[model samples]
Target: MNTRILIILALIIAGIAGWFFQQQGKISPPVNIEASEVDYEATDIKAVQTNEQGETEYELNAESLTHNPVTNQDEMSGITMNWEPSDEQRYRIEAGSAAINQQTGELHLSGGFTLVSEDKVSENKTAATDIEPIQVTGQTLKGNTKSRQVYSNEPVKVVQGMNRFEASSMKANLETGEYEFGKVAVTFTPVERQNKALF
Candidate 1:
């Protein structure tokens, strides 16, 4: 997880639904939020939430959803979250399973996670060589909607352009677009120069 690559991921994942929770505020449990009825569990769910400016901010889709009263959390499996914090940037995240604290809006995802897509323009966008799409994977992660940050203590692997990186841990500050990685290993591939015709 190089600093540059890490920043790319952080910016994409940060600001992801932060305003969603801020607007919803604390979700108080009703009747302790036990999944006592069939309605508490649903399949193929899609949710769209707008921001204060009446602009669409995020969309969440899940294969199945359930409320866990014992933990007071909303549990979702096979989830895909898409966030568009601004018109210029968009990110798509996929998780095997996730739990959102009903009261605090804290989110924890586990059982493997991937950043499916990100459309943030980087400085290398205008480089002679095109910037390739990157892929990121982690076993578990935690995110705070309040701080707009994501953290992972598990191993993180990223493939950016022609570079590959791995780290023992990762922390991304979306606000500042900074990434901190622990004990990182990285490899870069050099591309051969292409000849162009000058008329």
Candidate 2:
């Protein structure tokens, strides 16, 4: 698979914030947001969006969500989101916590999150190495639906097959698969050690 195609995973995962906020419609800006209690809460919430072509584009799930008035955003925990930009590769995310503006589809996440890019598992293990999965991890991330941008100023890491990358910051264009990383460090795992390190 093309490296460019594999990198599309970043764009899809970053778009989750946009999806989260879009699911919530017509939210009013509240005064005394800090005084607001949990207006709405749910244990399992799944929000799915489809394109004009009627293909599922993104599915966002959260283990729990709380309406916080002070921040005026939905407080979400145990978030697991998936995006299918195309039929070939899927992007998945497991995030610790996120804050989303219900009105604007702005998203910010903290604690930690892992984004994975992988093809559907096949019965044949022989081809697993052919299109190696890519992983990106960060302590913080921010997404804007209007701008279609996802970025992190904190250190970010990316791993693919036997290689690992660390960067001071990462910015990816959601509309394009273009990625920009700051101060990067790349390490290639030796063949003898890769089998033990990779999942």
Candidate 3:
């Protein structure tokens, strides 16, 4: 498959923040905490976002979360998120640590992160067994929900089927399915041709 076709994985994962923006807006802003202190804290957190049609857009979970009143920021650890853009595809995102500025829509993901994209299974077939999933991994990422943009300055890796790609840096538009990379290297598995008996 062309690497360009793999851009979907990046776009779907970038959309992770789009649903997160809704959750951020719903959480009450912190109050009465000192500038250097966190006003709210929680463990084993789970947040879900749904569309107007009552369909789930994304679900987010974290091992722990803390809110800074002064910065209007939420810091979380052991984060995992699942996003469903449509009935055909699903994306899973995991991160070690993240911080989001609810007010500014700024997001910072660090301590490594991984995103996997797969087709949804239907009554006719098992998607997981039939189709290969695409995986994207990186050390650090930054983005803005409002802008629907995500980028990484650290090395990034993507794998699908027998294909692998590595890039020194990457930038992608969440809405447009466009990607840009700096210093990319790709390794593709050779296709095997079946022998045909000459008639």
Candidate 4:
């Protein structure tokens, strides 16, 4: 009887230990993670236009465009362009969001678009440069083709000589060499002498 009792106690202890071991095995370890999911989308797309003289004259669907006042750099995304050059004064242009540099005059364009010219004279001139490469900087549009006047019905900012203007919308008539700014306020930097006089 003593032997039987000891055997029974050992069996119970073993069963309990086995059950404990099974429970321990069933527990899952904590998961370790250092990163999470991220979602990104494109924003602020626009189109722009300019003349053979390198003046920005028009823009279409002009939203999400930004200009650095200090750097004189202009950037636009999502573009559709049309250009027509006149018969006289042969002209050339380089444009793109990536190509724009106030200091260097390089326009960078992205999103894969074409630089087209409708004018015969302009097309001949453009053939010289292989229709200027549109440089792209992070999906932005840029560059001008030689034979075509740049056209965009989007909102636009124009830097013509000493004058800077922006409009809710714009249209450039390359044939007539004229640009119409939608009813909008234009801004320009004051001359240094004029600013000094005010102070």
Q: Report the C-alpha lDDT of model 1 over 1-199, residue by residue, as the tens digit.
A: 5999989888767766676678788766744644463337888989876766887777889999898776777799999988665544565778999887746758898989986436566465753334455566899989864465778998999777767899999887544445688999977567898999987
Would you list the clashing residue pairs of candidate 1?
none
User: Which has the better lDDT: candidate 1, or candidate 4?
Assistant: 1
- Which structure among the candidates has the greatest lDDT? 3
> Which portions of model 4 show Cα errors greater than 4 Å?
1-84, 89-150, 188-199
lDDT of each: 0.75, 0.77, 0.80, 0.46
lDDT by residue (tens digit), candidate 2, 6-34: 78877787698678878786567754534
RMSD of each: 28.3, 27.8, 28.1, 15.2
In terms of lDDT, the poorest run of 10 residues in model 2 is 120-129
Clashes of each: 0, 3, 0, 28
TM-scores, one per candidate? 0.64, 0.63, 0.65, 0.28
Residue range with the least summed lDDT across 10 consecutive positions in model 3: 27-36
Return model 2's CA RMSD, one decimal. Answer: 27.8
